[model samples]
Target: MTPDDLADSELPMLSAAQATHLRALAAPHYREGHQYSLESLAHTCSRAPEEHWPDLVAAHFDRLRQASQGDESAEELLRGVHARLLPVDSVPSELLGSLRYARVVADGLVFAYALDGPTSVRLLTDRDVERAGLQALGEAARANLMRVPVRHEEVGVEGGARLRSVYGDSPFVAGQALFLAEVAWKVVGERLPDAGALVVVPTRHNLVYHPIADGSVVDAVNSLAAYALGAHEDGPGALSPRVYWWHRGSLTSLTVIDHETLTFSLQPPPHLLGLMKGLVHLDRAGRLATRAAAEPAGLEELMRGAAESMDRLVQDPATLADAFRSLVSLAHARCAYDPDVAHIDTWDAWATATRLGSALFTGAPAQECHLGEDLVWQLPAFPAEPPADARGWLDALYLAIVCRQTDRIGRLCRVPSETLRQDDSVDEYVLHWIDTLRAYFSDGPSMDDVVEKLVATIETSGRDGVTHAPTEFVNAIDYQPAALFHRLIARDHDTFAKALAEAVAEHGGYWDGSAAPRARVALGPLAMASLAYDYGFPVDPAQPCLPAHLLNRQRLEEFS
Candidate 1:
């Protein structure tokens, strides 16, 4: 979707449909094998000649990243941006989960919009009673006469009159908590969509679902619901709702991750950090509990134990690693989808290695994912402060800890880019992860998954015996040009399906049986022996987490 398409869609801001089209248009530009540099991205997205725009992004994402790092005033500007950009339920995730902090003005606006029950659940607060439940949360919020207007019809009724609303402008962390919980609460109850490698977490930060009235109210006041939309923002203010200060460092931001690309202070307030941690624990517990309750008695027991195993982190390091790793992978998939993340920072290298990718292999049609609700609800105009879109701020944190494919997404997410933040070590782990996958795919037995696809790439080879890997290429893996076409550029179902069929036909039998690798393939371990050499994880039989099994077994029994 061209910017023109976006403008024509009458979307408040970037819609799901337009974004998908733009993604298709930009797909050909992501040539990792040719080492497509940032220098040429502009041509891929611009109407102007390649020489004119020079960069794909508008230079605003960087500015916002900078301002988020340097200026206190930028916090408010960031909030203002959220006010503009997140004007509706259109934010990449739930109302306010973790990407950024909020100021009073943004809070007020969010509350007013939410009071009408736009996209938000009730405003979370530690004070609300969990016993009150969703119904109660709604009732309490409704019963209290907020000075802000409710719906116009309700506003006119008796005692529906305005009262001095108590808007709590807490620390950045508090704002983050509210965002996560609101989003989480909403997600936990809904039938979430099947996002590829995506996790639609309703709760993030340390916020969890607490039943205590005060806890509930606090959750309400200081919570944000979240979703991880797959969007990229490397082109400066690509993260910005407003074009002017998008990445300008002057427009919006409370905190910026993906630290390496720009400068920023990573010092979150101690309380905020603690609060976030607490909320996260709560969220994990809730997920575990919910999953267990909804599941069969046996697995429920296991999940219960897993949830309770937080107590075992110090005593059971291996168990902790397994649990954490699982969580990390889930988070990584979502980070890929989050719109606010600088694409350059958040996308996996595999994502950039476009010479052999299937851009539309799994995506819905271009016409389906239209512009979002944000332009009206959230984003502001160019030069205007963008609504604070905290999806980047929060999700990137999870991406770092969970995806651990740090080298791939860290710089893109901005976490490693920060000179001030320590060696987050996120890359350290993710690199280890890539090696693990490489080894597993190489030396290990082939499963039913990628074998056929691998053979297809080889079979479909052109005269040079060079055919693209299903989602990657050989020579291109080493370097890439300014831009190259990938599969699925036609923006149609037939094209997507046909390319998938061809790729599958040629390579679909690599794992027809238990035979590991006759030769090198994308998921091959031999292709990544160096990776296995660097960091070790169990291969083949899948190593054991003995303690996890024992403790988790016990915990599940209790729940059962």
Candidate 2:
């Protein structure tokens, strides 16, 4: 009988002709009732195509017959055994004696030990567990499960929640959630909040989790629950359709199922609710403080407020890097546009950002870039690796080159242009600018090639009037390369000066009526001018975007 015939019947039973065929295909050692029950045969047939039913049934019976004899020694069995998670009530009462060693780990889930083979998985029986010793077997299973290689990726969920998914083709992937704490530390490190995380093991090959941080936990719970149900239903080795709270190494079910209605919903316990509420309150407070700091104000006051509120405003390494970029932008704006703002004030902001960035990214303290303290090119221990975000890496490379720090520039260049292209958010023009700077600094390509690429980008961007960069940043992205190429490679002082003025105007327009300190400067133009001034290009000290005090580099000479 076909699979559809079995599905339409009240009892999934094989017909006489099908039974005869299955019996003929059975292994020589297969016993009729013990190793090849009619019910088991029907179930296997329903899940596989009729064309391959013979081989499948033959292999299934052979596996059962081999498992029944238990020829392998306990030591050999322990080597391949691993923890397996199964749906609740999946084991029949008659087979319960064999799986008595299994324990309930969470709602709708049973954790059991199994010997994973190339072609099949054999669930350990109570007799096998007794011989291996429960403690030794448990340890061996966990160790074996952990050995499986898993890939990690971060995905953004709706409502501003981020989920980390760890998956593998191995059948024991879901069981790794049993040791979620260790995995969280290995993958998340300092990013995992003190409150722990929300977790879901949907199928034998997938586990997704969100580190509990703020009010977004509510959205994360709903998203994870929906994902779990869908993945479980589509699974080759389905495990659970429930969400669980993983707190301090403990897993508790967060899903509540209505048996009568056959539906499920997530409901966090009181303790978890209280924790989430507290995080929500803090999140709101931090946002309010950031808003206050962004109000119309003097650059120094705004910088001071930002530095003070950083701990509350920044949540992760990514945000910390962004905060540093914001501060750098503000320092550039102040130096370029606000002549009244002291160069020392701009240096102070840079020093503060560098210190915070160093602490966060490198776990090192940076020496203060004080006024008249000869610029120490290497005082701050830069992060060994560049930021993964294309924009952040660009900002870092700009700072390194403008400061004339060869070591820092070399470190940043280790990241190839192709790696930066992976971030789709960055504009093509911005990437071209990065490539030009990398090639120029490293002497990797001819200056003519760089100029040709820059001119082509400018022509294309001007013709299309379209850019991949965000609306607020399009002008800055367009103007940075033009200004840098003119000053550095073309040696066209007049063109460089014009490009600088346009960049300054674009910066002002972008930050018009904004109270944030970063609105005061155009960092890209200032960096380009710094390079020109160093190269003895007669830059107009009174230029709108090039602050004279900063161009002199007297402060930078203090370290010398």
Best candidate according to TM-score: 2
Q: Judge candidate 2 at residue 13 and give its lDDT.
A: 46
The sequence of per-residue lDDT tens digits that candidate 1 reaches over residues 97-170 is 43233222321123221122212122322222232343444334333322222111101112111111111221
lDDT of 2 by residue, 179-239 (tens): 8877777755534544678999887888999877556777788999999988876555667
Q: What lDDT would each prediction earn against the true structure?
A: 0.24, 0.63
Question: What's model 2's overall lDDT?
Answer: 0.63
Residue 289 in model 1: lDDT = 17
Considering summed lDDT, which 10 consecutive residues are worst modelled in model 1? 192-201
Full-model lDDT, candidate 1: 0.24
At residue 67, give the lDDT of candidate 2: 56
Alpha-carbon TM-score of each model against the true structure: 0.18, 0.48
